[model samples]
Target chain A: MEVHSSTAGAAAPPLSPGDFRELFDSVDAFLFDCDGVIWKGDKLIDGVSQTLDFLRSKGKKLVFVTNNSTKSRKEFAKKFGSLGISVSEDEIFSSSFAAAMYLKVNDFPLDKKVYVIGGEGIIDELQLAGYTGLGGPEDGKKTAEWKSNCLFEHDKSVGAVVVGLDPFINYYKLQYGTLCIRENPGCLFIATNQDAVGHMTDLQEWPGAGCMVAAICGSTQKEPIVVGKPSTFMMEFLLKKFQIDCPRMCMVGDRLDSDILFGQNAGCKTLLVLSGVTTLSALQDPANDIQPDYYTNKVSDFLDLLGA
Target chain B: MEVHSSTAGAAAPPLSPGDFRELFDSVDAFLFDCDGVIWKGDKLIDGVSQTLDFLRSKGKKLVFVTNNSTKSRKEFAKKFGSLGISVSEDEIFSSSFAAAMYLKVNDFPLDKKVYVIGGEGIIDELQLAGYTGLGGPEDGKKTAEWKSNCLFEHDKSVGAVVVGLDPFINYYKLQYGTLCIRENPGCLFIATNQDAVGHMTDLQEWPGAGCMVAAICGSTQKEPIVVGKPSTFMMEFLLKKFQIDCPRMCMVGDRLDSDILFGQNAGCKTLLVLSGVTTLSALQDPANDIQPDYYTNKVSDFLDLLGA
Candidate 1:
């Protein structure tokens, strides 16, 4: 519970991982959160390219883990390239991708229709993974129509629950989602991510796909196996992709709760950047106790510490 | 788990000393939620007053238990009187009043300023209970400026954490609110209720007073002693005020979760009316599984049952 505040030029590694160690020290792979850390709404964060190059020089692997299931891996790759960062579809792990992998690996009948409650990203990902997407009832006043037609009537024909971001997600949809899961307990309850929301501009603000997932989760009292950040699913995917163990890894991010806590929980050293949801004043406040192993002002500050 | 949908009619008993006899055949003092059961948006339901008088003539006691902490018992009496119903202030059990009573009786000390994060209702109630209503930091931009003047200062003069229906509540207020309670664990954490939000024009609105309570409760991981409807606080208030015991009571309401569940938990027979949050459709939906001992189309039907 001791507050760690250091403003020295470079200090000894007194507390395990010190302030001035290489930002990517002893790390074989790196996991980054896409929206806030790498780019915030249409604009890329400064030094992301140079930092990637520096990590590439050190032979470190990079994987972008995003809870934004509304976009597929291909879509992410294209978006990343558009932002001047070179990335492959294989180098990304989205909750949708994880959900697809979960379904594929389990050998669940892929030809069946999935009652989706998300956008084009989820639809593309699931289809690419070899599953049919389900549409809601025609009348659509209540999801009860979908319940009778898509779910209950066909037992094993319903492949999985591919819940993603849909703004029109309402209580009736929530009711049907629960009803489907409750009806077929063996039917997979897969969520792309459990993130309640992502902050966009005020006018276009929308509840992330996770809010719908959570509402159903709340009703059923069931914890879905989350695939996105902070969940070990993405970390495992990244580790397997890079062929690295937990010790030889470091997690860098701006948010403390999900990003830093993810690193801490996964036994990796964490770097907290004060460029996003968390700030320096928040950490210094006596009330909050979420402290990271190392503190850097932004992702760009990694260069000063690493001397790359 | 059998669904009970019997309303006041041919099969139901006329208003007797125990309205619960037709259902549970046991129970005493009746607890009623005022917001939705007796009225909706300030409009009294049919047969509400006549039903109350009939029950009174049968020697059954009743208390108005409400989660709305803004108004005092006197205020409630006036509101009820305007609606052509005679309500004594002493017969009303308000969570705000209960919280104030708890603070006063425990000698928790009104020596410090109580930071308020609710509507004028809760603030006025706190004032009536002999506590100073303190506001948060008048300034925002500078954290240092915030530390000195904000109600969450790490000082001894702060009395407790009081929260209620605050439409203006945001991240900044929550951040400071979290700080205040964390800094002083002994500082009383009093909430108006735990409903995330209540009804508005459309959409599942924030359950007023209850939402902030839930937020703080989630953050601190400490459940506050709820004083509103469905709590023993209201039950005890009724017993003390009306000089009655539990065995001879019943409860009438529209929503099963709040009103009926309150009665069920409080050991009284519950009547569910289909005029508010929980409709007959919701109850019949299998997923909900909420069934009151008796069901009525509107609040007025209870008068017919009472033979008023």
Candidate 2:
């Protein structure tokens, strides 16, 4: 295995096949950001399946970490199956799961319900964690009333307001969530992720969880406890759950802010790939503070390391 | 007419009946903020109708200026009629109308269309200004597909994305609006207002147009040109449209941030009424920068000056 050493403060150079093999050999566990590194939209990245197979053959622990809270871990695993990659639901750690785990770890009151301003994934996770959730897709439909004077029947049992990505996000959800946070004493404001945008395809990017989170935050004048990537909460959850050594774990991602920053905060080796939103020029920019330990063209480039 | 003097840079005390008469006599035109000062949640403030009548009897040019973009000028006029107040559509100026006027004044391309992420008010104003509008409530329904892979057929003719208060706001509208702004070359990004929350009633307040505007802004990283109160654009539009003398115009409102600031910025006398969102303590707070020229308990307080 080849080793190309560099100073800690400076940006690391792109990794060679042999250098990547050496790095891969050192790490026992791999945490991957799903969207850019493994797939873009519905299509899977070429050679990713073979790369994962090689990693598995080397007895490496593969964990899929994503900020997308629209789908539960089981659903994500189903998506993986459709993409021709075999993944267990337990091996996938989504932000929604992290949020649920957060509530569970905090010993949240079982009797109190959580008001959700998101999609099914957060609700599924909350339900799995033995917490009742209200105001998801079922409460997302537009009311027939002329004026927005629908008297929201306030439930005093609501102890938390959880926000994530909601395709069916409307004014009512925001209103109810705001009411929960503002009126309910000791009500927690939590966000699964604060991703500004999600790439649907190369040319198509849409507003993500951050938009909804920002909307709630803007109205309530309250900052939520974000539990997704870039926040140490998700990483801490993974560390506690899997008992993986941070030094021997590598975080492979395509985005600098969330993915690479999460790796840095998690005290893991980080690799940035050029296959997604980030560009080569962005990596070389002197203004950027967050730099990966190593970078390559794409996650599939690790296939060359296996050959080496 | 009565006169009372106060030290400069101090919070103005509530006006006496005689002092209010003096202020009223000085102004030939009176601009009102509808929600709090004139009415609150479908209920008209007592004595408001009589006070407006007295002002009209004195030959004051009354204009209903509101940041609410939900209803068009004609609709607003109808609402006024329902509230037992006679008003012409031309005398009502809303944020939606301001946005349309802004485009028209700037000589926006006639061939280009506008992509709306709002309600009917903005659409009506855009149409009235001879610009084709797309993607409002007509495109707000949730699509059948599970995945967010809606084929957003981009129209190159879309030159602006106008956002207002939309109860039917969904991911598709946000997605389509973002696409229009990012994909269309030099497409204008405009917001009617950035009001954080709107009061539906005493017990209910919901996220307003600002929440939706903030969502789009968070995703696009693009700052929109806001045309509502406190922006100066709306004031400028009103000033030019009516050819009103600034010194002879008095702005009456319940909120300090938008209404009072707007009046101050427009070089007009400002009257703050405690009938709305802000309280006496807030007005008296030294930390607050925006202050009105005159203060009253309510718009109806002016009635005492007229000996009603």
Best by DockQ: 2
Per-residue lDDT over A1-308 for candidate 2, one digit per residue giving the tens place of the 0 to 100 score:
11112334598679887778789888989999998788877878788898899889879999988988888999999999998999999889999898898899899999999998888999999999999999887777855232544466668899999999887887778778888887899999999888877765544567778889988886777888989987868777677768888878888988888888888877888899888777889888887777888889887788775672
- Where model 2 places Cα greater than 4 Å from the true spot, the runs are A1-12, A142-150, A200-203, A281-289, A306-308, B1-12, B142-150, B200-203, B281-288
Q: lDDT of each model, Cα atoms only?
A: 0.61, 0.82
lDDT of 1 by residue, A187-249 (tens): 667777655334332111223455556544544446566666566666666766677776666
Docking class of 1: incorrect
Best by lDDT: 2
State the lDDT of candidate 1 residue by residue for B43-88, as single tens digits.
6766778877876777666678877765667788888999998988
Clashing pairs in 2: none
What's the lDDT for residue B27 in model 1? 43
Candidate 1 ranges beyond 4 A from true positions: A1-27, A32-228, A232-249, A252-257, A260-308, B1-29, B57-60, B134-157, B196-209, B218-222, B255-257, B264-269, B279-299
- Give the Cα error of residue B132 in candidate 2, in Å: 1.2
Chain A vs. true chain A, TM-score per candidate? 0.78, 0.92
